[model samples]
Target: LAQRSKAKDWTRLIYSTALSPHQIVRGEPNAADREKDEENDDDFFTLKKATDVDADSMDATKETYPSDQLTKWDNEEMFDSIRNLFITGRNDP
Candidate 1:
């Protein structure tokens, strides 16, 4: 589950990378559209996700997404990924 969440985060980054100059710079979602967006919750990528599958049956799967699985990005590898990204819930880098 933890890994899925990680991948899910990365997937959002990948999708955000696609935008026309006009769409990105001048076209923005209006308040109503934004409110509607808040109501939509779909996972387009199966990357590190915070969701669980069936807990029974042969196809049942369990997933967990605690922050302790990986080292903090405050180290070298993270560099400045946060500056370009809007990560939430983290008290620190």
Candidate 2:
């Protein structure tokens, strides 16, 4: 990974054509093989520099955490009670 970082213009977005060991052993050809035949091989791995985060879909591919007002239960309060079970015990007087 460090060696790839040395390249100044190296882009962060990455596209990879990877195959499982089983996929390779079964002689099932994939984009990797076609890439090799086309002289686009990069040390047996076909990787492309991605320009956009969601190039094809271009839709919002992110999720936002629930806001305080939207949350049903207070997470901190629940954890506090669970933690108390280890430090304090309930008994009948």
Candidate 3:
């Protein structure tokens, strides 16, 4: 039937449009093209590289705590509590 053939044609069009590459669908330049343009424009910008002195100052300023001073949780117990709450639909275990 003509209606069935039209439905099939529309289905094919929808699928092909969905599955096609983004650039093809949108008629835009792909990532490779943009990357090529970026490569060409790299000379226009100046990038600052971190010096050894900066790195050393950053490392010297960090504070560290002892392992025993940090709060610890039993992961298995926490997971079981959460699972029970979800299964029972109750806030308290």
Candidate 4:
């Protein structure tokens, strides 16, 4: 879950940087982008360092599961997985 969250954060960051005002105005990332990039660089390094610690902590807390098990899931299981992906408690309205 932590890794998934990080991946989502990275996706958001990339899209945000790609669509920033400087990129729209200059048709390319430039000096203004550099400022935001520097901030993201700091975040990257911080996330990298934290990942090392998180990896160790997660290993101690989470149970190991076989990756191949997903491939063996039945139709019902696959449907449940797809449903879970599209429907979350947070999106309820």
**What RMSD does each model have against the real structure?**
17.9, 15.2, 17.9, 15.1
Q: Model 1's lDDT to the true fold?
A: 0.51
Residue range 1-93, candidate 4, lDDT tens digits: 455454444455556665654334334455875686568775644443222133345436666778776555666756565553464623433
* Candidate 4 backbone overlaps, count: 0
Clashes of each: 11, 0, 0, 0
Model 3: which ten-residue window has the lowest total lDDT?
19-28
lDDT of 2 by residue, 6-33 (tens): 5523232222335444443343456876
> Is candidate 2 or 3 superior in lDDT?
3
Those runs of model 4 whose alpha carbons end farther than 4 Å from true positions after fitting are 1-26, 44-93
lDDT of 1 at 90: 57
- The residue-by-residue lDDT of candidate 3 on 19-57, one tens digit each, is 444334344456886687677666866455333254445
Which pairs clash in model 2? Answer: none
Per-candidate Cα lDDT values, in order, are 0.51, 0.50, 0.54, 0.52
Candidate 1 lDDT over 8-92, as tens digits, reads 4444444676644434434444598666555554646434533334455354377556775455665766655565455543546
Better candidate number, 1 or 4, judged by lDDT: 4
Alpha carbon lDDT of residue 9, candidate 1? 45
Q: What is candidate 2's local distance difference test score?
A: 0.50
Please identify which of the two predictions, 2 or 3, would achieve the higher TM-score against the true structure. 3
- The deviation in Å at residue 90 for candidate 3 is 67
